[model samples]
Target: MSDLHCPARILLVDQRPAGALAERLSRESLAATYDAPVDLDEVADRHRGETVLVVGPLPAEHAHAGGPVVLVEVDADGRRTSPWDVPR
Candidate 1:
């Protein structure tokens, strides 16, 4: 909607099911999906040039994969947690 070209696909990796975020992303016209596997290497390989990875509260290791990675945190009330709030 913002004239931003959506990636071919978006991979959402979260510790818990991210139904809400996935729904929100879908509404934004971005092709999004979810995978809850313990290992991400395989998924990353399959989506090589077509996916933008979105990670939730997981280890940093799983946050960076391919394309542009977005780290999101949602509170119990479904409010998004700001990365700036994370103390250095």
Candidate 2:
């Protein structure tokens, strides 16, 4: 939904504190919010029929949703990238 046509509902999940990131994304008009200190497994059963975006230093997480489970990664320069950014 970030393409500007429709606003997207983004589930911002992190193991540690990520208030800044969540706040920034929300300002952009996306449904961005933080639900931290939650493991992938625990978050899975709680929310259904929504996209799950996991921002992690470790590997990806196991989640449940009607939509896709996206992996969000940030570089040292603070540039964010995702699986969709990868070239086939």
Maximum-TM-score candidate = 1
Question: Which consecutive 10 residues in model 2 have the weakest lDDT in total?
Answer: 79-88
TM-score of each: 0.32, 0.29
CA lDDT of 20 in candidate 2? 61
Q: How far off is residue 39 in model 1, in Å?
A: 2.1
Best by lDDT: 1
Q: Any runs in candidate 2 off by more than 4 Å, and if so which? A: 1-37, 60-82, 86-88
lDDT of 2 by residue, 4-79 (tens): 2222223443343345644433444333334554454344333222334544433334242212223432222322
TM-score for candidate 1, please give it. Answer: 0.32
Error of 1 at 48 (Å): 1.5
lDDT of all predictions: 0.38, 0.36
lDDT of 1 by residue, 1-88 (tens): 2212322333444543345554544445433345443344444334433444445544454355422234332222322222221111
